[model samples]
Target: MKDTLKYMGVVVVFLLSLASCTKKWEDHFGSTSAQKTLYELISENSDFSTFTDLLNKSGYAESLKASKNYTLIIPTNEAMAAAKADYDFTDTAVVKSFVGYHIINSIYNVNTGVDTVKALNMRNKYVEFTHGEFDGVVPTQSNLIASNGIYHVVGQPLKPLQNIFNLLKSKFFSTKQVEAIASFDTVHLDGETITYHTSPIWISEVRRNMTTESRKYTYFVVDDESYEAEYAKLKPYYTTAYEEGNTTRPDSTTTFFTKKAVLRDFMVEGDLSPETLAAGVVSITGTAFQLDPADIISRTKTSNGAVYRVKHLTYKLSDQIKQIKVLGIDPRGYKQNDKRGNIFFRDKRDMNGALYQDIEIYDHKVTSFYAKYRALSMTVGKYKVYGRAIMGLAGDPQTAVFTQYVHFFDPSIVAVNEPDLYKRPVFNYLGNADTRMAFEVQPLNPNEVYLGEVTQDVYGNMQLLVMCNGTGPIILEYLRFVPIIQ
Candidate 1:
C-alpha cells in the first residue's frame, strides 16, 4: 500500500511539469498569431464571408494581405446580402469602386482617442468617423485589430458619395426635367444655328457648385407631377420667340428654359433641417414663399449632400425671372451710331463678387451720344429700369461722373442710322423721357440706380437706348429691367 501511494505522487508531479513546458512553448511561438494580416482575419471569420468574396472579386483581396498599414471596414454577411440590390457585382469596375471606398491607407482605431476623424479612403473620398459611426454608418463590431491594421465590422456597406448631378440622375427621371438637365451638353448640329450653351453661364450656380464633392448642398427635386405643375405655372412668363399662332398666350420653353427656371433655385447651400422647411419661404429666391411639409415625399442622404424629393415646388414668375439684365459686354446690339476706336470694353470685378464687362466711351465729349443694346425677352408688363454705371476703369484713377438717360424705342420703327450725335446722319428721338430715368454715373459698383419705369404694350424684343447727357466718360456696366411682380 505504501509503494502504490509513492508511485501516484511521482506521476502527478510529472504531469504538472509537462503542462508548464507546454505553456512556455506557446508563449515563445505566439508572435506569429499576432502577425496575421487584416485580410487573414477577415477571410477566417465566417461573419465576413460575403465581404471576403467581394474583395476577391474586386481583385484587391491580395492587397490587404500586404505589409502596408491600412484601416479596413468590413460588413457582415447579412449586411452584404442586403447591399446586393444597390450594386451590380457583375461589372468589374463597379466592384473595384465599391471595395476601394472601404480600405483606407492609414491606420485609425478607437484607441486613437479621437471622436471624429475625416480619413481619406483608397478612392480619395472622405469617410468620416464620428464616435461610433463611419460615414454615417455605425459599426456593429468596433475596432478589431490585426497585424497590418485595424478593421471595423459594420451592418451596412459604405457607399461612395455622389455629387448633385449624379444624385439628380439616379433619383429623378422626369421627362422635361431630364431633357433640361441634359441639354447643357455639346450638340452636333451642322449649320449656322446658335447654341445657347457656348459659354457656361451657370458657373457660379450649377457648374462649379453642383459638380464638386468638396461643397455640400441640398438639392430639391420634384417628381413628374410636381415638374409639370411648376412648368405650367411659369408658362405665362417664359414665352417662345416663334409662337404656334394658336393663342396670344404663353408657349413655355418646356424643352429647356422652363425646366431650368423651375429648378434653378432648388439647390440651397448646406443641409437644411426640418425646422427650416417648416418655417416656409425657405428663401429659394429673394421672394417669400411657403413649403408644405406634406409635399416632401422622401429625402435621401448623399455623399456630398442630401436630396429631397418633393411633391410640389413653388416658383413665382417674378422671382424666377426677376430681371432681364443687359450687360454692355453681352453680345447683343451693342452697336453705336458711329464705329470708331473711341468705344472701349473694360472688364471690371465688382465689390459684390460679380464680373462686369463695362463699356466706356471716351473722347466723345458731345451730348446726346447713345449706345443701343438689343433688349430681348421683354414681356408686356411694366419694368423698373435700373442702370449700374461705373465711372472709371479698374486700375484707372479717372473717376469722372457722367449723367445719362435711357430711351426705349421699337427696333421696327427706329427712324435711321445717325453717324454722329452732334452732327446727325439721320435720326429720331424717343418719347418716354422722364426726369427720374436719368442716372448720375459714379464710382459706386453694384449699386442699382433706378431709372423710372416703362410699360410695354407689346410682348417681344425691343431696342433700349442709353443716351448720354453729360461730357464725362460714359462708363456703364449693365442695364436691368426688373418686372414689377404685382
Candidate 2:
C-alpha cells in the first residue's frame, strides 16, 4: 500500500513537471491556443476572404500552411477590389508573382521596434517595411502573431510595376520613340530565341538598375512637347548628314548619337529628392543643369528607381565641353617602359578642384602617350587643346625643362605632323616655384588649331600623342579641348 502511494506521488510529480514546461513554452512563444497558421488565420477571417481566394488560386495556401516561419502580408477585400479594377488578377502568373511578393521569407515582428527594415519576399525582391507601410502599401491591421509566423493586413495590394522600358513605352514616350525603344535583335541559343534591345539611351541603364543592380537611380524625363522642341533644334544638324549623302535616315545622325547624349544628360546616378535636384541637377553625362521645383510635372517611384517629368530642359554646349572628362584615355595605359628604356608611372592627384591622373616620366626620353577624342562636329569650328604639365626639380641645380610633341590625327588615322601642331615647349617650367603648371597648345600664329572642314571620311575624330623628353619627371594632368567661338 505504501508502494502504491509512492507511484501515485511520482505520477503527480511527472504531470506537474510536463505542465510547467508547456506553460513556459506558451509564455515564451505566445499562446498557441489563440494562434493559428497564416493559412488558417486567413481562411477563418472574413476580412481576408479575398486574400484567401487569391492564395487558393495561386496554390500558395497549402505552402503557407506548411511553411515553418514566414511573414505574410495580405490586403483586405476592398484593397483587392481596388487593385482588380487596375490589374488583371485572372492571370495565374501575375497572381502568383503578386502573392509571392507579399510573403516574406523570414519572420518580421512589427512591434519589435524596427522602424524600417527590408524584408526578402518569396519572389526574391525586397519588400520595404515601415511602421505604417509595407512595400508602399499602408497596413490596415499589423503585427498579428500566428502559429507559424506573423501577418499584416494591408489596405492596398502590392504589385511590381513594369520595367523602365515598358513604363516609358506606355505613358511617357511618343509612338516613334516607343518603336525605337522596342527595336531589338534576336539571338538563337540552345534552340531558343532571346531578344536583345538596341535602345542605347538611359533605357538600358534604367532597366539594368531596376532588374539586376542594387543601386538606385533618379531619371528625369522631358515631356513629349519639350522632347519634340529639342529635336527640332537638332534636326538641321542631323539632316545635314543625310542631305550630304553620308547617312540614309533623315535624322540618323541625331537619332543614333545626339539623342542618346541628350537623354543621358538628364539622368542622375542616385535617388535625389526634388529639393536636392533643385539645388543643382548634375547628370551622369557630367553636365549640370538647373531645375525649378515648380517645373516638375509628375514624380513616380519604381522598384529600383524614381522618375520625374519636367516641363522643359536645356543643356549648353559650353557647359558640356567644360564638364566633359577626357574620353578614351587612361593614365594607366601610358605607364610603360618604352623602347628607349624610359619609364612612365601614373598616379591620381587632385588638381585645381578636380581629380586628374598625372602621368610622370622618370627618364628624359621621348615617351609617347596617345588619346582619342570622338563626336567632334564641323559646326563647332576650331578648338584649343589646353593641358596642365608639371616638371619636378631633380639633379644638379634642381632646374627641369622638357619639350612636348603634340600631334593630332584625323579620321584617316594618319598623324597631322604640321609644325604648328607639334613641338610645343615647356620653357615655362623653368622659373615657376610651383612644380605643377597649366599650359595651352594652339597654332603658333593662329588663335587655335584649325581642324579644316570636317567630312564623313574625316569622321570628326582626333587622335593625339604627346611625346616628352625632359630633364626630370614630367607630369601631365589632363588634356582639355575647348571649342573656340568663331
Candidate number of the best TM-score: 2
Candidate 1: stretches off by over 4 Å? 1-47, 62-70, 81-94, 105-126, 140-150, 159-212, 223-225, 242-254, 281-288, 324-382, 388-402, 407-449, 454-467, 475-480
Error of 1 at 227 (Å): 2.8
**Candidate 2 local lDDT, 1-486, one digit each (tens):** 999999999999999999999997687467652367888878888988988888898877777787478899888888888888776788999888888878888798664345657677877666777755776677777777777888888888787654444466666655333343343333335667556544443446433553432555777777667666655554433333333212233223434444554455666777677778767877765778877788898887765567787777766655654311343234323324342244343443332334434454444543344322233442323444445553332221213454454444333333454323432222222332221223333222112221122122221334444544333333454555555442
lDDT of 2: 0.56
**In angstroms, how far off is 326's CA in candidate 1?**
6.5
Against the hidden true structure, what lDDT does model 1 obtain?
0.68
Clashes of each: 0, 0
lDDT of 1 by residue, 411-474 (tens): 3343456322212111122335442256777765568777667755544565666666755455
